[model samples]
Target chain A: MTDMYDFFNFILQIRNFVIHLQCSITLIHNNNMIEIKNLSFGYLKGHWVFNDLNLTVEQGGIYGLLGPNGQGKSTLLYLISGLLRPNEGEVTMNGTSTGLRLPSILSKIFIVPEEFTLPAITMKEYCQLNAPFYPKFSFDELSENLKAFGLDTDINMASFSMGQKKKAFLSFALACNTEILLLDEPTNGLDVTGKADFRRFIASHMNDNRTIIISTHQIHDVEKLLDHIIILGKNGLPVIDSPVSLIANKLCFEMIANGATPSQNEIFSKPTFGGNNIVSIRTDESPETEINLEMLYELAAEKPSEIKQILLNN
Target chain B: MRNNITQDKFLWSRLWMHIKREILSNMKQIRWQLALIVGVVLISEILICSNAYDNWKQNDYFYNSAFQDPAQLPILLAMVALGLFIVAIAASMTFSSLRTKAGKINQLMSVGTSAEKFWTRVLIYGVAPALFFLTSVCIIDLIRCVLVDSIMPIKAQFVIINPFIDETRVKAILLFCSFTACVSSFFTTVSVYSPKHAFLKGVCIIIALQTLGSWFLFRYGNILRPWEYHLDLAYWTALGVLTAIAVVLSVVSYIKYKETEL
Candidate 1:
């Protein structure tokens, strides 16, 4: 009987070990990946854009990088994508320094700048030239994306208007199927329908292996799609870097009725034609609400310490 | 397949693809430049040959004296100089993609080793332009031979100026080639380094450095004096030094290109 009990115990231990191994593998596959450590960068001497900035971007989320004008939102995107080298530290993707711009790292990352120039080639020719660099590029996806944007593969990009060109480029960027996608002001020149298509296309294409960072001042266009928010403070420092779920849990965003008095718990507020849009700390009884990105940005920009303290306490 | 794409090391296939892409993307501009070359060469040759014909009709002795040796012809030397200037200008435009933020981002983010990209530009701007110029001139020279032999009042063996056939022509071509290589390499490096107006900056830098080098040589070295130096020895020495500097500058250009940032 004791021997039997020992055998049963051994079997249980094996089962536990197998489970642990599986968990470890899953964790390794899906974890915080891109790490920016002690990164100091500046365009000029003694005026740092990002001084000793440290950031870690987890895989598989749509990150909205937000900041006011001239605060280095685009600069940060460039730094992360390895287009800009830091002065003091490094930005690494999967433990490899991005500044090296190794093909391994670059192939997995694609950046769509706010402004760009397409060669005078047709979309097909452009893809023929560029698609080989990205191993995971899918022609079918390119076709689908282009169709969604109301563009054709045979159209000459040089003849495209700015909006149409943006759509085409964005479509190509998505079809590259890179792990990390960086977009700066993606929706700026996009038409109303194009913006809707952009959101839909991005949503449809997102997967567990991909992480998209969209840096844009046009909050409404991307607010619904963001899984995380990163707001840069003065000197390109991030004041709020948190998941949308956590943000919703800690703060409530809502519009007060026209006659309602100002709430004491309000962290930030702005008057609207119909009512006042306010961001306030969430109480235990309060239900989670949709994030008001504009209001939230104002709160973080105005009362950074207060917002930080509130989020930290939760 | 993903592993192949992610390989950071230099691969020949990828480099070849990059070269193809670079050429195809700039195909239109290249076509325009080639047309311009043909136009310029044709017009210049016609003008020179027409003037020579008129001179020949006026006086055969003066014409023969003026065009006694094709190798010593000022027109050939001037054509070579002009070709070299064009090469330098093309070299200065090597990093034109970096002029705009968007272009810079696109280029820097493109998936290829820096060596691959740098070598592509070197081949396209540095080496290929010089070769193309040489070929274009040779072809035009052939056309000129036919035109001159057929139309000249006194045809004095109007053969093509084949550098391979004559030692003097070969030496002159080599000297000009080396000088052009040096100029192009320097201009290419400046293109990688300068923020704006790279061509102007490169020209200014060359002028300043040449002046400084001449001043130092004149002030310090008596043996380097124009009258004292042996022409052949000085010529060979200058050619060797220029070639060495060109090689060094080419390497430096690659290094600068690899480390360039937006």
Candidate 2:
């Protein structure tokens, strides 16, 4: 009996060793494109913008970075792009720290800032000069983007209005074909038609190898395009999940009449023009409805722990 | 060894690409403004030279003595001033993009190593502009000589030969070049640190340096005279110190730029 007990203990040890080995291998080949560990950043000392924040963005798909006005949505993007360094902790891309900014790493990322000034040159000239840095840049795709945006390649960028310039820049950025694209408030200066064009342009350009993270307070602009959503709060990230998982596992977004009583499961409700938009827990096996991003963002910000617990429990 | 070589080749290629992009972007943004400024300077210099040539022609005694072995004082002074002015402009605008928040983001986020970006800016705004200024001075002087020769019977030519050939003038030219380089490097360093009003701060520092140097010279004029101490040694010492400062400033600037956050 003693020998049998020893044998079973040995088998248990072997099982533990195999599990550890598998975990090591997964870490070595970490598929997540970006990982932020214990990130603490602030513009001024003693006034923390992000406090001990941690986030992991997987490879591929468009991610909507939503937050309140001063919750560091833009700052987070800047840190990931290596434009702003975190006070503590680090931002890594595929297990490499972005702060190092190696040529190999830099070539794989592009950033489109909210307010950027283009050189006073034609779009063709700009591309000719700047495109060579990005190894995967495609002139054919640039041409297609220009055509789609109704912009002539030969037109001087200095003459372009703000909206036109943004369109042209967005087109160029998409054509650069970097693995990671970080856009901060990209649709701010865009018109209604320009925003639609922007959406189409982004959707057409996305590939399995590419990941685009757009940080914006305007959730409606990017709601339909997002595969994953990250809603930041005053302290840390409260929500980091795909739309499908969000709709299926945690919350049910519904539009009810103005005078109708909300169900007991309804966690949050907001008044809309025609009725009240309500977010409740998913109970039955019915097909998930489309998520209301605005409502989701509000619930996440105001009652993060409640929403977090529901998500975790589900 | 083979992998290392391939990596080096890739790095060099990327550096070259960045340099080309910087040059093209600068040309697009500032070409017309640069042209206008250069045109104005050239015209003004031509006018001044023509007037001096007329004076030399009118005064036979002054013309005969100066022309016998032209002093080249005015030409030398013009060249020195032109070199300083060109370097000042280049240094002032080298890292101007850092002044604006948007420009800083655009610049720092671009694809390239920090070292590569530093060298690109130095090549575009420091070395290239200085060389262009030197070439312009030589060409303008040649043109002035030709104009004088065409107009006057008495020939007074501003020789276009290399300054290194003249043992007497070599030290002066070298000193001038070194001073210009030092100033340029210093201002470039200032641009990296001072985000706003960089040009103004740089000019103020230069003025302060000049005042201090003048005071030092005045205070020790008798003790440090050419008769007591070897003038060549002093000149060489000053050049060495200035060159050291310039190199140190450039290295510091590059390191600061690498760590700069927008």
Candidate 3:
């Protein structure tokens, strides 16, 4: 009887320790807006875009969804919006399943796709019709952004140029004041000035209630803005990764001029027009080493395995 | 706790914007069609009312001409078309709504425009056109009444069908709009299934069902003369079965659209 009592007390002590451990973990994670588990999807009779793809995004940071022309970056966003159904897997936002494009889920999330064709109606009318859906959407913010972007509310949507269209879409997206924002190729049509403004808008509006995911092949535009990077590649390399770790440790790409041959450990290289070849190597370096996103993409595309090994090493 | 409809409450608002824009732009695109349809329908209504008046004269013109009641056979038959026109306009709008705002909708969905919002947009896209169509039909109806001094035949006969026909005129308008809503909802699912074009699907459904129905009758009844056959029970039963089949197909199409990824 005494031994039985001791065993019960031991079990109780272990349970208390586990509970404390769980509390600490919760404190460590304060702002997680989206969490996807085993998300695998494909159209009927087609190959899967992502199989067992697991990802989690917390709030108040810029996440770059980088991939080639098509590796399902856009598809993933569609899944989150419940615009597309997954053959298998589940998407949860703040502990709720995204099924049938639930209104609560929609009010908190906004998307801006690449191609756009606006209606013949004025922008103001458009806003009036769509504003009620987003509880946090602010007209003042929309007006301010429109002014900053040099967009006139009086102009019909059909009148804007492609760059102007993108600007309008971006401005409209920001006004939604959603907790989750999805932007696909937001900077593709913008001029340099517009791109700069886009970066500024992102920096200014970020808060606990919002998380922005930008999918693009223009790594150069996002290099400075991106805090976390998920690279989608199937060239026998790592499928996803963060920019900070990629630049700070595990991978290095440097230009080696003629007369200075790189060691065999060099992950990849090819002779260039000026006789200086760019080579990638697996190494741990301080993040002070600025990342050349364009060069990185090219080198990684050339040698996906080298990048994969670097990821595995980490 | 939460029903599916409430999730994308914002979508209805957004769709309202999209619908307005589509209606404005498409109205201009179909301006010629609108003018023609209105002209033709007005002329038709006058001709039909005049023919009814002529028929009354031939029959000694004693009954009071029904003007207030919309449920009379003559008006209902003329307006049996009202709902189809409304639904056709709604379907056309839906076919173009997503394509017009493709970038915005795609991006919005990624950002968390809920599926409910998408469905709401579909509803608005379908209904906005219907409301506009109803307005146009109403104007034509008013003109017909104004030009013809005698009672519009519809105003004469509807209280005979049901005495509660006092509200029949207004109810007809509402019913026309509602019938279009249901048709467009099904059309939306059809649109999603065949994004490039739905004309063929619509044609196929109409033709195939009709052909199959006649074939079923021949195979089941096998009667060449009506007087020799007493198959009213069988005929009604067949029609009921066919209608159930159509309903089931519509429901299935809706489910397919609900789960479609794009």
**For this target, which candidate reaches the highest DockQ against the unseen true structure?**
1
Residue B135 error for model 3, in Å? 7.0
Candidate 2 chain A: worst-modelled 10 consecutive residues by lDDT: A236-245
1 or 3, greater by DockQ:
1
- Those runs of model 2 whose alpha carbons end farther than 4 Å from true positions after fitting are A1-28, A236-244, A259-261, A285-287, B1-10, B28-30, B33-41, B62-66, B69-71, B159-162, B212-227
Model 1 per-residue lDDT tens digits across residues A105-158? 799999999889899999999999999999999999999999988888887788
Colliding residue pairs in candidate 2? none
Show where candidate 3 strays beyond 4 Å: A1-32, A44-46, A207-209, A235-237, A260-266, A270-287, A312-314, B1-40, B46-78, B81-146, B150-192, B195-200, B222-254
Candidate 2 vs. true structure, TM-score: 0.88
Tell me, by lDDT, which candidate is best.
1
For residue B44, model 2's alpha carbon misses the true position, in angstroms, by: 4.1
- Looking at model 1 chain A, which ten-residue stretch has the lowest summed lDDT? A15-24
TM-score of chain B of each: 0.85, 0.84, 0.56
- Can you give the TM-score per candidate against the true fold? 0.89, 0.88, 0.72
DockQ rank, highest first? 1, 3, 2
Candidate 1 ranges beyond 4 A from true positions: A1-30, A261-264, B1-3, B62-72, B151-172, B225-236
Worst 10 residues of 2 chain B by lDDT: B1-10
Q: Taking the tens digit of each residue's C-alpha lDDT, what string does model 2 give over A97-183?
A: 787666556777888988899987899999988886677889999999889889998888989999899889999999989889999
lDDT of 3 by residue, A113-154 (tens): 776556567788777656655778789999989999999998
lDDT of 1 by residue, B93-129 (tens): 7887888887788788888899988888778866777
- Prediction 2 global C-alpha lDDT: 0.78
For candidate 1, give the lDDT of residue A189: 90
